[model samples]
Target: MQRTFLQPDDVRDLVTDQFGGGRRPIALDRLTGGSKKGVYRLRLDDHSTAILYVWSAGENYWPPSLTVPDDPFTDASGAELFAVSHAALVAAGVGTPQVLALVRGSRYFDADVALVEDAGVDTLEAVMERDPGAAVGPLSALGDGLRRLHTTVGAEYGKLAAVARGEASQRRRVEDVIVDRALGQLRGAAAHDGRIAEAHDRIAGHVRHLRGAVAERRAYGLIHGELGPDHVLVSPAGEPLIIDIEGLAYFDVEWEHAWLQLRFGDAYPMLRPVDLDPHRLRLYRYAQVLSLIEGPLRIADTDFPERQWMLDLAERNIAKALAAV
Candidate 1:
């Protein structure tokens, strides 16, 4: 299938078709989130707002190197998963962004999916930009949301066994591609830099550590997979509304802790307004960083400090992962 990208007009048409009122979107604006997915906010005739999330079925987005199946993950499958998981998180009482509607396959060769709804508070990255010293109340709410997500849906593990299996299986496949490519690249590159090799070794060790945690019957519920400050949105009431589960997956109960550490452990001192379990949070951050090392080398431009920061963070994660082992 040919790769197709949606335009503003195409998005408007999709909205009209989905709503079936011939009501076109008054304004179509691009959303700032997920690098792989295209999010849009549409204004309807009823003065209401909706969010559209377009998911593409391609290796270019996830990386051909990562362990993902060659088969395209169906849009319906994605819609079902997103609706269920997002709703379940909310039902579990997590303050996540509400999913007004999910529109798929309306554009771009059954690709270019979208989620439409009213916008949540500005992203954490935006908030931090305005008020760097803002209270941890928002961040705390985010942590709580993650905890809720993990604790809830314990039963889904059995149902999502296929998902877990696919993920684990693909983990190796994608890793193999990445390793081979990286090794080849490293070999051909100028003077040998130990960073790439060290990164590979350290990240591998971190994942191995996580495997042990899961094997020990410490399986936590579904993790956000990509739980970062930016992925979370703060509501006007100061509640954190977790958004963007593009990386949702199941893992050890403590993987969330590890993730939190890898991403925000460095900023622990700054999170003073809201009181939280500091020790556990740090662990989450550490594991979080470790997990990220093995993830796609690319980070969305929407993420602050740009791709450079992501690579830098990945490097940092590799070091931490090595230290842990």
Candidate 2:
């Protein structure tokens, strides 16, 4: 298994190139990374922080041969779209880290990397670890921010609305090509066969209900394709900022809303519902589990706990999907 690792020197060059004799970076350290990129925090002499995002093929340090489609809804340029999107959202009144400079380099380690200003952001997941109840404020803030962002996505990309709608309408066509197809490959590569067949039956049921529910709604317009706890941030004052909006796409509004309920309801105790439909919320929870089982397999380390959490969600969704079927 190959992976991209950013050394101290790599960060220094990135800072030097972007900052350019303005202020020499005093120190650099690895912060966090996703499946495709590694982030680093560059500390200036003034003690301010700038975040650097390095794109990589995977953990393998191998460059990806595949190219993402240049769709307005999807993030094809990797960090370019995210860095720009985050900056755009911030300028548009959403809470996002400031972009000091955006620099792109070819094959820094395994993938291209971008250096961005650090926002002192602690993911909602990290916040929940210390104070689970703090999520409400952030979650609420995130909701407001997402609403704003979804609006921008719809307005700014009005010219590309047809393209976005095309993708959404052709979603089933790409389902196997993008998701199910990749998951199939992963299944063959990594041999972890638990209750796959049973899981499929449950997922089928949930899909049925989800489709019907979507049909009933007029149209939610563009939404965050992936909206889980990890993608949200709770500021110190309890205000929420929704990060990682590159997954922006034209989808059912419930797709994004459901994620909040699942993470807050199941993972952390902070999210107690006072006025939301628990049953409908359960649909999003199940959707997440089914997707988790599908591909990439990004989650926590504890397998049993993760499995149980997703299974419980899947079962609930299965019942709903079956009802629709």
Candidate 3:
């Protein structure tokens, strides 16, 4: 099927109708780095802006064959996921861009659309790059949000949308679920990359061994599964607001920290994280590299333009995953 993109007029009518204003959107520009859905900035005639999320098959760059339906970690897309995730975060007192309206069916087009308030600021990643000193406040804010978010625990462990709809399967162990998904990615990655293929046994064994080392836990902390600097926005008042939040769920706080440590690098100390399980962190860090290796290779095979970046990501992580063994 041919992939389609959205135009300003495609959303303007919906925007005006939902927002109930004479001021229509003057421009709807597509934002980059959105692989799973169409992310657009809807600039209004009044100089205000909102974000539009369109979940459609055409908008996604990921191959359907790559994702497993049973994997809790896979494909946290769609309007329901976004809405539930937004609500979950808000309930925890964690800041996310406020969702303005939702269009469930294709009232305007052949996709689920959500209009959300724009973060209206540079991403924490960009801010950290342009001026490291400027990043201190935002990082502090983000760290605070994470601390609060992790305090809110849940009985079940999985994506909020799935959990809300009773779609999450009852499992004996959360680490088991994590181990299963990581194994799938690494095995698939081994098929394509000679490095992972050669070290497949050792890498797979390493992951399984790490899983065995993890202890059974009772409490599950809420987490932004993909909490990278790029996923955070720093508002003008120095508050950090999380975006691309469809993957929000209750899980090990250590899992969130592992990603934060990898993405935040030297600045991770700003978060002042405490009392984490090292065993889980080690397991998650190494296993998530497998996901990094496979996900890029999968998407790179599609019509995604950033093929080289994807390959480079997979290539670099190949060494990381191999070294973990």
What lDDT does the true structure give each of the candidates? 0.51, 0.50, 0.85
* Candidate 3 lDDT by residue in tens digits, 32-103: 899999999989888889988999888888886555545566778888888888888898888888888888
TM-score of each candidate structure, all chains considered together: 0.66, 0.66, 0.95
Better of 1 and 2 by lDDT: 1
Candidate 1 TM-score over all chains jointly: 0.66
* Candidate 3 error regions (>4 Å): 66-70
Point to the candidate with the largest TM-score. Answer: 3
Which portions of model 1 miss their true places by more than 4 Å?
1-4, 19-22, 43-48, 58-60, 66-77, 107-109, 132-134, 153-194, 198-215, 266-309, 318-325
Task: Compute the lDDT of residue 187 as modeled in candidate 3.
Answer: 77
Candidate RMSDs in Å, in order, are 6.8, 6.6, 1.6
| Model 2: per-residue Cα lDDT over 48-162, one tens digit each | 7776666654422222222224322333336555654565566567776555655555544445665554556678878767876665677666656666655543322211234
Poorest stretch of ten by lDDT in candidate 1: 67-76
Ranking by lDDT: 3, 1, 2
Against the true structure, candidate 3 has what lDDT? Answer: 0.85
Q: Report the lDDT tens digits of candidate 1 across residue range 1-325.
A: 3444445566665666677766766776665434556566777777777776766654134432332232122121355466655755666677777765565555533764655456564877677668866636777666566666666544222223345445333333222332343333333221123554555555444444433332123233666655667777777777777776544545444445545554565553343322234433444444344335544244322233246756675666556555765
